[model samples]
Target: MRSTFSAVFTIFVTLSVCAASPFTKRAVTLPPLNGKFDYQIGGPYTPAADVAVVTRDNSASPVSGKYNICYINAFQTQPDAASFWQSSANAGLLLHKSDGSLFEDADWPGEYFLDTRTDSNRQAIATILNGWIDTCHSKGFDAIEPDNLDTFSRSTNLLTAADNLALAKLFTDHAHSLGLAVAQKNTGGELGASGKSTAGFDFAVAEECQQFEECDSYTDVYGNNMLEIEYTDNGISAWNAACKARGSAISVIYRDRDVVPSSSKAYHYQEC
Candidate 1:
């Protein structure tokens, strides 16, 4: 149930782009821990304050010479991109309920779940995602923030945690093969559960970890190599608590839930 960017879900990017094959290269350097950072997945702007890292949606280009994290909605369908999925070669990959209706994210009206129930569907989806990863590299991004890792939690009984992690490994391996660092999008509490090193994730992009008391879970694995976003508009109460209690190594920031551009009247962004 992502509140940000739900209303403007019409934006879509083509998934057909050239990409290098996966699992043939080594992982790249991660985003600097404890560095200034910004999350601009909604829109991009000049760095707010010498931000060492910035995350932007796939529709946007990477910031030059910055540790850019390309936002890839890997687990579920973005509200705006429903048409793209419907028309995609892997259209069958969309999950559906027993009644044959679309299985939505419940929290987000237009967002739908991607079916990772089988290895075949996973590979097909990976083909499209790999193309996106290629775009990140071709556009000069240093890393990728694959969103919707928690989609399985909303898939009713159609998907499992194992299903999601399997898909995640595919993404991480593909990104690493392209020499791009990969990030765990949320505190799924599955990192160590899989018996993989950091779940093969180079870092994390946690949203309101302090509010949920999941900060230690991430730092326990990725350490300071993570950035967290807290939103006042979202009724987040831990902003102050996080600021007061967080270690210097954890980069934290506050933004309007919408994450509007700095120039927008709805914009709200801050750092701690």
Candidate 2:
């Protein structure tokens, strides 16, 4: 009986270890960096062309058989879901100013910042995000694109790059555990080799790399594993010049800032 109990304990330990270990390296095929890509975070519409990769919000289902990427607002709150967090038992999870008022993302109304200043707050936020990651995996997403990674830059000096990077690592690990590749969303072209290596991102989804003249920063790190999105007319012009110079080896697309579906009058989608 003693031997049998020891054997059972060993088996349990091994199983636990397996469950806890995430795939450190990508075990799935990555979206082609040069393939036509679309940003559909606002809403999903019919694919207009030979799109190779597409990103959509977590609440939406993945496009059938495409290299679908799930978008999660990991570092900041979504504007529409303000009340969801405000009314939660973990309301304190949101960042607060010195006077105790909730900090907001000024440009994005209704969107608040998540507190990543301490281990407890980071872990609490991760706990909430892990559920979304699980849903993304279960729903057959090929990868995850956690938006607002640059939140620390807008954190009003209350947060640091290290704080956001630590939170990013948590999300990256969780996505990998479920066999989902993770993409680094905008770090403002400032993620040096150390930053990229520390976060362990599998790919990158950059916004306005052309307009910002930071395309090299992403391509230098992720190689052909980067997707670019341009929002404005000038940004589109910049994208055209970049694509013409870089050739078909770079995936580029243009969409309205909101990325709304075709039914909306504001809907806009195009590819390079």
Candidate 3:
């Protein structure tokens, strides 16, 4: 009886260790340094032949034969998915206002912030985002570009940088366990600077870092692993300057604000 009990306990311990091994260590792959890439979160289309990397929305299919980055709106609810979030099972994950109303992102009306103020809320949010990361892995994505890491700034004092970083660490840790690298999107000077190392972010996807003259903020941390996109509406000078300055060391592209497909009339794309 004593021998049997000891054997059973040993088996349980071994099983537990095996189950947790993946989360403890995995070989995560980072994006190619200075690789030409496309930002297609608006919609996915055929990337140019020279493009080595492509980013697409979570709902979109990965581009074949290219390093694909799956875009997940980790910080807030998508405008169209409001109903799903409003459902009882997931509603508690959303941040609420003083009046008990949903907190909406002013820049993006209809989009609501995810509550990361508490550990329970952050864990719940991480569970859903981790599922999305799982789907990205199953779809053959090389990495994840979690949008709105800077949502705390737009959170109207309800969410702090610490809250967002805590949630982001959950994301990066989960993504790495699945061997998927995570990108730090925007928030160049603040969270991008302070949280990049702590959160385990492998690289950065900056929108208009050049236009805002904060490209160095990302490059300083992510080095040549930075992927920069400058909008045409912001003027060509920013794009031109970025290309001339660190173009050889990093990936830089000019895209339209809408990021429409190449077939569209307003479509625009340039790379350096």
Candidate 4:
């Protein structure tokens, strides 16, 4: 009886190890390094044949047969969704000033920062963001670009860098679990190298990095996996400078500030 019981226990342990192996080995697919890229977050349109990657809003469908990235305003409330965050269901998720007025991003008037100061608030925000990640996965997106990670800079001390990084880990971990890679969007200058690993980001989506002269800040971490967008308003000089420096190593594109579609008169797109 003792021998039989010991044998049964050993078999159970072996089976359990086998059952857990897949989860331990599971990995998310990262985007192709230095691929031709397009940023269509303003609205989705078919990409040119040579384009290897495209980023679209979460509400937009992924472009077929390309490495598609879904954009999520993970750190703040969208201007149009202000009412939803203000609603009772999402109370305490938005940061408030000492006077109890809602704190808003000065550059983006209607958009407000999501409170990330406490574990409870971060978990609450994650519940809502994870649902969006689920949709991005369902829509066949290869990665996630959680924008406004630097919202802490605009938080006027109400939120700290640590606060936002904590929430970023939540976003990245959930994305990875669904086999989708995550981008550390436009916060390299602030978060630096350690923050990249802490947040579990696979790559980066850096806007106006050339204008800010911060391309190296991202490249030091993401290498060729960085997708750079230089605004036309910043002039071709910034774009030229970026291309001259890292064009061969990373994906670099010049786009209009609005990122309008080709059909629009304001549309502008160029690559190096």
Estimate TM-scores for all models: 0.90, 0.87, 0.90, 0.90
In candidate 3, how many Å is residue 76 off? Answer: 0.6
Clashing pairs in 2: none
Candidate-wise lDDT, in order: 0.76, 0.74, 0.79, 0.79
Clash count (model 3, backbone only): 0
lDDT of 3 by residue, 82-141 (tens): 777898988999999999999997767777899999988888777777778878888899
Stretches > 4 Å off in candidate 1: 1-3, 6-22, 190-199, 234-236
Ranking by lDDT: 4, 3, 1, 2
| Clash-forming residue pairs, model 3 | none
The C-alpha RMSD of each candidate to the native structure, in angstroms, is 2.8, 10.8, 11.4, 13.1
Query: Candidate 4, which segments miss by more than 4 Å at Cα?
Result: 1-25
Off by over 4 Å in 2: 1-26, 233-235
lDDT of 2 by residue, 1-272 (tens): 00000000000011112222354644756797687887777777777558878888788889986899988888877666666678766698899999998898787677788988998787767767777777788789999988787777877789888888888787778777777888888774667554568877888888877777888887888887888777754556776776775547777777677677778897767776
TM-score of 4: 0.90
Candidate 2 structure lDDT: 0.74
Q: Over the stretch 20-135, how does candidate 4's per-residue lDDT look in tens digits?
A: 11222138777788889998887667899999999888888898899999888888877667667888878689999999988987766777889999988987787678778778
Q: On residues 1-272, what C-alpha lDDT tens digit does candidate 1 reach at each position?
A: 24366323333355533332436758598888777888887777888647888988877888777788888888888766877888756579999899998788777788788998998888778778877887888888988888887777666678887877887787778888879988888844654435136347777788888877778777777777778888876564677777676646677888888887888998887777
